[model samples]
Target: MAIVTTIRRDAVTLPAAELGPDNPLPPLRPLDEMHRIEDRDKDDLPRDMARQIGYEPLRSLLPARVRDGYGRERAPRELDALVIENDRLRATVLPGLGGRVASLFHKPTGRELLYRNPVFQPACFALNGAWFSGGIEWNIGATGHTTLSCSPLHAARVTAPDGGEMLRLWEWERLRDLPFQVDLWLPEGSDFLYVGVRIRNPHDRPVPLYWWSNIAVPEECRVLAPAEEAYHFGYERRLRRVPVPSYDGIDRTYPAHGVHPADYFYEVPDGRRRWIAALDEDGEGLVQTSTDVLRGRKLFVWGTGTGGRRWQRWLTEPGTGGYCEIQAGLARTQLEHVRLEAESDVAWLEAYGPLSAEREGEWPGVVRAAEERLEACLPRERVEDAYAAWRPCADTEPDEVLAVGSGWGALEVLRTGDKLPGTPFEEVTLGDAQVPWLELLRSGSFPEPRRVGPPGETLVAPHWRDMLETAPARPLTEYHLGVAQWHAGDRAQAVRSWERALPLAPSQWPLLRCLAVADQEAGHHERAADRYAEAFDDLCRERRDDGETWTSVTAALGREALDALLAVGRTEDARSVWYRLHPVTRERGRFRLTEARLLLAEGDREAARAVFDDGFEVADLREGAGAIDELWARITDEPLPAHYDFRMRPAM
Candidate 1:
């Protein structure tokens, strides 16, 4: 005979020991152990493993005020009965996704549906039953292609108490045959409904358990996340048009800041999931109540988009806001760990839908809990709302409600009109026929006719043998051509071309620098030195305005340029430039030490030591100056040189 029993009539008692701490996203193993449920096997699992779990686990971190009217803190009872909703008799459907029956009477168990009627691919199983094939295996669960995991067997059913008719069962074939309209429901008017799931770590070592919930928010509403406080990789390009905010709320301030508003992912590690009042502009709120950081299993948080071509939208269009993805895991990056020897899985997920329009008097003391949770995910005082368009009220009118949070409200609004404009860098249009002057020079194809006699015959000997004297392109282009000519062993022609380019071309730093080098190559030492001197002076002027301290690399480059100028017979110019930099160089630690070497070259031993003694302030100069001091000591035993070879270098 089969054992028969009715729903236990006795008031259900929970063992005090089973009730874990009142926290967001509580662990599922405690409940599973109490109910004697088998844990889920770590075989091929789903991608979006984080999405399989609901958002309820994060609720425990909510302010006590907001967590009110939810479930009471209770211990687990020995012999727990996992209740399953069997039919749609009392189920209620939400606003979107028509015909998808939801168990309205049953308070969400906080346990989410993981693999329902899963169909396996040749190698894997579907995690979210959408795009990805889950983490481990790629199983196809579409109609007519039902697959099941070989290990950690799962069973589902829709039935009344013992001896009652079966409502439904977790069978792939059966679910396919039945309409998607079917839904499981909790008893009528139940304040809280509890569903349990088992996480089986079949492996010898522990694997991570991850999950996420698909909570739908209104299109008009926005999301908030603490990007400045949290490590955020800007917007997901795949989900651009998808509805949702980039970040979850940072805190309960008037307006938020430091978030990119587009596709961005926010990861909260285990023991870090906590936030309060995920509210919309119209005041729709979904607060996190608890989180179960399952040991050895990482929790993933995700915000899905309703519609878009890519995973994230808003790279090109900042106005296009997408969903916010809030997740908890062992690591911050996409996927952290999985061992062949470990057992890890995402267990439960619950979504509390659109709350009452007016939530009054802070739910209950959940503020501290919520604040703590925020601390785990981000630093204190970092939470902020999403970026949105701001509209100011008329200044002429003295309004009452408008003045309440107006001071903050004004700052909350993000201005969209001030984006930096892009500039086009194409050549000015002359005509469809554009001349390729650089190409002409490279090809050596001068269009000007060759010297010919009066009879139009090629002259055996021409009055002038200069075939190409004028440059065909812009002055800078011609300058480049001159450099190429010098490399090709045509020094005279190169020098002539450079002379033409110098005055015709505007003084762009790059061009001026290049011209200076060209003059040096042409052996016009005086001209090269003058060019370098002019360039260095200009750079100093530019940097002086910004008060930017010069780096060792930059200072070295500048010194090298100065040396080059002095080498080219512009010693007086180099000295003038050097004097201007002396005060600034004295302020710099490394430059001051290097200045000592310059002093030694000038036969000023006392001056060199003065700088070396005070050069400790120049952090980069200490080692070299120290080495020089040691060498100086050795050299003191012998007669010091009248003048040291302090190689002067030019400034870049």
Candidate 2:
């Protein structure tokens, strides 16, 4: 039997090394140049789209208003890199670089538990661009790395309640009007580093937020977790299933599996406390265990194949070995949104450390050893008690217009009339006015309707039109009205509304896309093609200016533009727009299929076949065998496979 040692707070003593001026790491580059994408064209697509819609570009829309304090460039300064250490373990924090954990080292084995990039190399992989591929990156906000990932955070060195040293990193999330803080502590003699995160909504209304911790590790590691299945979206954002960690009982360790590069979000069973570890063949590596608040674990691997190698190069500098990510999420999966109510905050703790096996055949013993230590560090009772104490109080207000609450694995919003049975509601009789819940939700606004209940999708146009007539000249309002009109099938009215909205928010990519769609539907193919091109260009500019990356919606709009250009016989323009898309987006199987279709239409069967083959490779990577079969069916004029859904359009 193997002996397991549990560390306690009182038994440990602090190490001698201190985090001060004398032990600073390299200073970050200037903010202006840090996140910028190079070789981008100086085309103002938003301005051109605005002109096409018969409006001038709005000055107010030069930079996104939601992102406060983001447009201005900060002066270069030498920032300190803080470190917390014990006799066995050491952790470093880079405050200037999103306060990321720069390095986690195990002294006895001289191993780096977390991948440490040699320099701050910002790449265009995050929703808000500027993502560095090493260390544990804190992502908070809608999706991807939050707007704060590349920005400097306020830092402080404090003493924990048990007299342990801690490094606190904090900042206001300007876009969401929330304040978030992270406290990192390395106890005196423990081999683990603890992380505590708090995100508080300070406003009167509720805000939607998403958060994930992306921890990078060496590619030659095997993830150990007790999940039976993994979920990922393949072509067209359709959900696809695959086995976790392995497909055929054989462990699909990194760089060893025949599977294509893909994102894997494992579904953890309910009521189970899960711990995830990424260990090398020698059974030595990092382990992450968290409190109940974090319910999901994910793996992102850019495989060792050609496409994977290309992506690895795109994310990091040359000669830097590729890495795999072990991620943890606040929700059941990535891309799911949660709400933080007014004055409410969510808190959770995560502990990371080194784990090693006693012998090669005793790898499971290492997992058990880590789990025992983690259980001792953060007992289930302590976590539950902390949650009970910190959980938000229920809302008792009767007249609240939009009540936001979170439970049952989703963020739920209730209007007065939409309340469930047994819930309290005001008796005052409000009129027959309805609210467009979906539209309002998408627009990031609270519905101000006279009555409750859900509104009809077609009725959204009239509501927004009425609001625009009486309300102030709000660009967002006008934009909402245009979306409503478009959805309601009032194409001309939608175009007109977008025309009015463009002058107030020219940089709004969705408005440009809406206009382009309207034009395309109206048979103005040339105009639509030009507008689509403009929209894609404008999105690229917005990313370069704001560090935003390609979203599914934006990617769809780009595809639409490409199709429109091809329809108008503007093949060159279509090709140019296709090239402008992010390399990640362009590598998708759907986009490759589109390219192949276009080549085939242009009477180049050989080129089309080659493109189709390339797309087939990508499809294989995405586990999109169904898509490959569909493409073959289209090329050979044969019936699609029986399981394939013919009615469903190909993913944009």
Candidate 3:
């Protein structure tokens, strides 16, 4: 059995001989709100400076410390005395060792030591000076002299040779405590060492301390958090949707880590958290930080392009590489649900001898022993307790009609096992803007709405498609009729339903859009082109009145519709429709670029250049610019090797 200790308060005071000037230090604050690092705004420098520096825009106006005639960025000056120190511990001070050592301490040391040096840190204890080049600071230090109580928390107490709650400072009895005061007396050739921290809590009052340390990484490193899905967001712009898929374990190189061309947002709902650990094949161990505790109330992760820390050793090559910082904490906006309990806190943490640190044998054994001790200290039930208890979004009564938001509704119902109420998709309310209502319905949490009537007779084709006789207020009815007719191979009837919808609901884009597809399927290619052109015109006119245009939907689908028009040799119609897309949008150039290729096929090289140039000026469309340039090269009679084998990338 482990040593049994008692709880106490107002215990015997330290002897006059042992009490130093720095003894009886100030108490540590609770770590309840420590995860608010993101809430603090970074200093804003001039815009010109920001553009000039690209991303590392923070001006280093603080005077550099001149050390031995060389200027060095300022950081903690002493560490050996201000913290637990060891020769092996000294090796980890290189500003990036926290990624290696992520664990908790299990037991408290019982003895205090009288110091000869009287400093917490050794002179050589500072880690490698500069690593993260993106204006983020990464440094560690210990105070040279500060009073540290044996036990700041009164949860447990130890009795020793001196008396109750008093720690003996004498040398060790045998092999233990080898590093503190007697490294020279150890057996020859033995490198093993032990440092101790004496702790006692004699008071009945609870002890708390907000213990935290940070590991920074380069601003460019990609961060991946486990979410049901992900969306890219540029902080400077209103959020623009980008095409990134949830990581499916099918591709190797295009794995979650490599797909990041821009910064992304990973949405972890309330009562859930994500662990975004970095992985570098280059020696730099992953930079893992959390905004809040994983398995806690709420956890968010962010990686800004501006400034961060880097690990030199983790570089792919000797002098070139990127850094990834994983910040573990709660989110601010869209995450007000996450909060900390008033009294709960992280009492102690250990950071050293990284998970990958390889020693002959004893190192791992020591770590295992330390972990086992920590596991034994906490009760099994509370081992994984979150920073705050989970709570439902709103109050509920038995059998009350309730509609859960699509994205998180399923999870909420799953946990509570509440009988969910049904709503028409059009009637459903979704609080979150990130996920669509259709997606939530498809995720298996909600019941699909059944139309009021069923078993209607299918309409037959021809008869001049009499369905166009119906009025437009019945778009839902016509839409259903159109789908049924299409499945029945009555293309004419489907086209009539679309034609009826366009006249009744002249502004509805979907009706004309469907008619275009119906026209193509019915072998009326010319008619299809006309319908697409009409729909594109409606969308452009609607945007003038409503500031919100269907950019995401149209930007993605319009190019597809135009490509179909071109496939049937209707290039003129394709060009007219392509010209309507906003030049600044992400999909602006794809259709026009497609047209350029079509012009090149017709031997019109100069016309294709003018068309490509119009849409290629947008910076976001640069991805498609390469394809246009290649086609231009081929059209201009530039000699290029045929049968080019682009480096293959495997993807699911």
lDDT of each: 0.29, 0.55, 0.29
Q: lDDT tens string, model 2, 319-342?
A: 977788889987655645566777
From the highest TM-score down, the ranking of the candidates is 2, 3, 1
Candidate 2: minimum summed lDDT over ten consecutive residues — where?
21-30
Report backbone clashes per prediction: 113, 4, 36
lDDT minimum window of 10 residues, candidate 1: 386-395
* Candidate 3, run of 10 with poorest lDDT: 175-184
Tens-place lDDT digits, model 1, residues 1-652: 3222112211223222121111111111111100011123112223333233221121111011000011112244432222333321122221111111122221233422121111111111111111111111111122111122221111123332122321111211111111111112233322212121222232344333322222222223333332222322222212111112223443312222332222133333345433323445544444332234321111112223221212222111224343332232222222223221243322322122223233222322333444444345333222211000000110011111100111111111111111111111112321111233222334543333232100010100011112133435556445445544544446576566666766655533334554676676567777767776776665555443333223221343355556675455455565566666636443554455445555555567788777644534322111001334343553255532322211111112
RMSD of each: 29.3, 16.1, 25.1
TM-score of each: 0.25, 0.55, 0.32
Compute the lDDT for candidate 1. Answer: 0.29
